[model samples]
Target: MEKLFELSHQNPALFVDILESIKDAIFISDHEGTTLWLNSASEAMCGVPKNKITGRNVRDLEKEGLFKPSVLRMALEEGKNVSTVQTVGEGRKYIATGHLVKNKEGKVIAAVAHLRDITDAVKNTSKLQEIEELLEKYSAQIRKLTSTKTNINGVENVKLGGKSNSRILAKKIIEKIAAVDTTALIVGETGTGKSLAAEKIHLLSKRRNGPFVQINCASLPESLLESELFGYEKGSFTGATSKGKTGLIKAAEAGTLFLDEIGEVPLHLQTKILHFLQSKTYMPIGAREPRNADVRIIAATNRDLEQMVEEGTFRSDLFYRLNILTVKIPSLRESRDDIEDLATYFLNMFNEKYNKNKRFSNEVLKKLIQYSWPGNIRELENLIERLVILSEDEFIEEKDLPQKMVEQHMSSNSPYISDRGTMTEILEEMEKKMIIDALEKENSTRKAAKFLGVSQSLLMRRIKKYNIQLVVEESKTFVK
Candidate 1:
């Protein structure tokens, strides 16, 4: 058989080609650590050319805090084979194998090292770790659900679900009159958790153990509302019950009465309410006797009741009576800083409620913050619940958001949705543009895939299908 050195020297190109085809970087160095030969893979691994690497000591090209000199010294002086795994340049992982090369005389002559890129393996491991963590979280949440019962009365001392400022203000207002019997009027836009604030106020009050009666003035007609608020004697009206009916005011004796949509009360009923507020006395329908109510009233309205009073739609006297202590709830957009905390809170809440352990991706969180929540906290809570129920994965990605929200993000500057094109076409165009922009921003197909929440192969196919151009000029500018 021909000697191995003689064969390699004679067929250097063939040997080099074989090394290049092996995928792993292969490098040969002398006993003194001088590089002898390196393949194309080695050149790529070191970010240097094979010609430049040859005849140079590997230690001399050492980048501090990355590859250590001791690794090289052990491979050379100790004549021992060594292997190490290291992370290089941002998040790429490499597995390096070092072997002592021996001459025909059975003595060490040089060292050969091979490095394989294990970045994908490392990423999959990280993904597995994340999945394990999510599973553990799900398990813990399930255990809690099985062991604990949900509090139907809702959160205590905190607004049920709304902007942080509104919740804070509501808490403060609740704390202020928690020990007092003064009436409170909570005013805000619809779905701003006004009723929730009233409940919190009641829950924190001294009469919490007593019955809590809730009545909506707008839910019933003026005549029915009167009968509902005040008890009716037997045979008070044609459809009256055979037995006497107790009113909500009487039912809430020594307790709290939540009057929702209080502005909907008619003028005559407002007069009766004003009288009740002043004298704490009320009379049942068809009864020849007066009754005293020991109830604490908490009223809520989404209307500008003061304006209604000016327009003669509401009574100013009733407004003043209910507005003994007013708490104004702020809108969602006014408290943009609290969006993240609210989102997380709702995510966790639904995660436990539904037995799902879904997490919001950072991109989704960013989009949530960027959105102009016109429906305020209520809209956000509903959106989160929808995502939790609909999403299949453990993570709620940007794609999981409502299409309108995604469109709003893309057309942040566009005034109107283009009418010429179909909605599907518009959405496709938006997706293409967003994918291209993400690719341009990241400058890597892999990173772009992550940002777009798609697989690398899928992203590559889209890049080709959309004919998207990489911003080479922008990349050059970044390098500079």
Candidate 2:
């Protein structure tokens, strides 16, 4: 038994070193289901250093919540190779293949497995739905293992507003995924709550107790952003302070670091960020040694990174790294059903904030739903805040809305055909009403048809279709 398990390290074929050099995680366990070895890649992807669990039993690792439905255990039980997609390392997706290792006498001596991290590969939007379903299914096992956060009705501190299907669906997805440490890429138009979504994911995570550091890539020049994200050493530059500064990555240790406007990041910095994503290690500027930070990354971008990659503006590698889990927050116009709910929520929020008792009039609510919010949620919230502060009356009425918004509402929801009917029926109804009104004025068919700009015969046909009487008793409809 000792001789069979010794080949990995004592055979001198350098199999252990070979596995360590490969990027995919590799694990080996003896026939008794005891862990024999785990390579460096396995240690990193599994989020457990080799020193912590070397020579430990596989059951202990499972009990410690290292990974779920162990492929190695399954392989040992079935006495054959097993393949599966498992959730590991705080909810990361991996493609795992476990094989039964045999001795020279054809006896099963150990179990070996290779795990490829597929967190980012499966995140392409075209494959996103299928991947999400897969993650959700496997994540159930993981959730049982790491149910550390206080959950409310199977959700966490996700505060996404609005009751539209799109909004609600988006919030539900975010809550389900918030417990994991996977990198999330939020794609939406500017001011569409991309940052808010990122924050919610962090707040709902196990790292909620840690800081939520955010840095906008577009807000600073390339030179300054590098220092801000990766930190700089003392005397690294002319204006360097006596005390060295910590990077956002370092500052957000064991927490969440949100990179907002990630599409605006320069090419060189993208490479560094990609390196950090891969290894969780970074070298500060002018530093002699690299340091590792245990931080979860959530990046938001409005630009089309794939298009930019085609145009050679954004690096493809970095784009993939950031898009491990993509959440596309829809524009406000796309989620019309949520308008009223969002409006009411904001109304109550602003009322409490400004110590006001203002309310939104029925007309105001109608107008709000009608207007197309090109600027998304941010624009809506800003307008509500302004209305609450500026309105003299207790209610924000139609007049309180901006001119453009009011005109848009009027244009969209005009009173034409307010009742339901086919196009031809509506035209006939209008024709009948016009003919009746004109006839009451002139009391003659020729003058009525003339005022209607139609032949008398056509007006007569429409009148028959609408069943409107020609009586002039009170200038109103009296069917005959």
Candidate 3:
């Protein structure tokens, strides 16, 4: 013990000098966020000697213009570590990260903070991001040109709506997962363009040159569907072809096989699909051995598979297998911001197809926006085609629109959405209320996360951000 004490005395600057020599600013504050100690670097960065700032409240430093808002004060208020950006002397940007200093008894005693100068790094990052954004835009244009030049069906028209957040999210999800060979399940209401999305994915994938095989499970009965998928040997069934035929799985070798209306697949076939997904092998009828194929599965369904699983109609294992890389597309009614753009696009497309020139009047376009499109994009496309063919006048007037559309347009104005500046403020207040309500209903962060479809850590961040009051202590136990 005496030898260790001598060594520590010989190298006391190892601790103090190192903290003083580091570039980042460092400081410590008490439970009340009163500055207790400030290292030499922090003192230099703030341009105030430690003797002047120590023993003073951190919030007071903000008032004195030593720095911007105090991250240490925020950490103390939130009872957790906090990070924020601050502008210091000479308009330089610094990133401050606050840590919650806990005692041996597991109670927070003080907060420590480290501030890093990031102005130059931030500028470089911004420039790099701008370059990347330009590259992404041109790459998309190139892909679109190729699709058009090659006359790719279904993919040429498949686009994420510009104005709808839901559609934007779906497009991002698709783009992110397309790089990997993961089984994808697309869920949406009928006519919501699930098949179009599948075609676009295949076109955008690494296997774009390979064939895209498609089939609708709902159009075939169990026996026929099975035989069609796993093509049989000659005389395997009553109407079998004289020569042995290849299955869709085999036909889509080294490509993508789209199974539309996947929910309609029978339970007996579900087992076969699961086996193939697990091992990429399927047995044909009247065949002694199984066949292996290299096909990527992209399944789409308009039904609730979870409900079907609970009712024992769908196998839980198959549901889990298909549920990877899920994407839920919004219905047309939920995408009001996209109505005008879609209507114009469809008008131009059908005009070219039918060799007619027809335009919608402003009033008719307004009516179209207000109408609740229960039949979704398919219905909209069909209606556009009909309007192009049936309307004798060059411009389709409001009177020509369906009667239901006019009635709905007159009553669709929402009362709560005026004054753009106030919208975010109102939404923030509502978000706070919702978090409190969800926490009350569930009494646990795990349930709250599930209810909100967000990570528990994010929920905790929001809780601290809002300083939400609670009736009971937050259930500290987390599920994952």
**Rank order (by TM-score, best first):** 1, 2, 3
lDDT of each: 0.73, 0.77, 0.77
Model 1 lDDT per residue over 369-402, tens place: 9887755677788889999999989999988986
Which is better, 1 or 3, measured by TM-score?
Answer: 1
Clash pairs, candidate 3, are none
lDDT tens digits by residue: candidate 3, 51-95: 999999989987887788789988889889999998776677899
Runs of candidate 2 with Cα error greater than 4 angstroms are 1-158, 239-242, 410-480
The residue pairs that clash in candidate 2, if any, are: none
Question: Which ranking of candidates, highest lDDT first?
Answer: 3, 2, 1
Better of 1 and 2 by lDDT: 2
The residue-by-residue lDDT of candidate 2 on 416-467, one tens digit each, is 7445477767555545545655554345666567656789898788777767
Candidate 3: list runs displaced more than 4 Å. Answer: 1-162, 238-242, 409-480
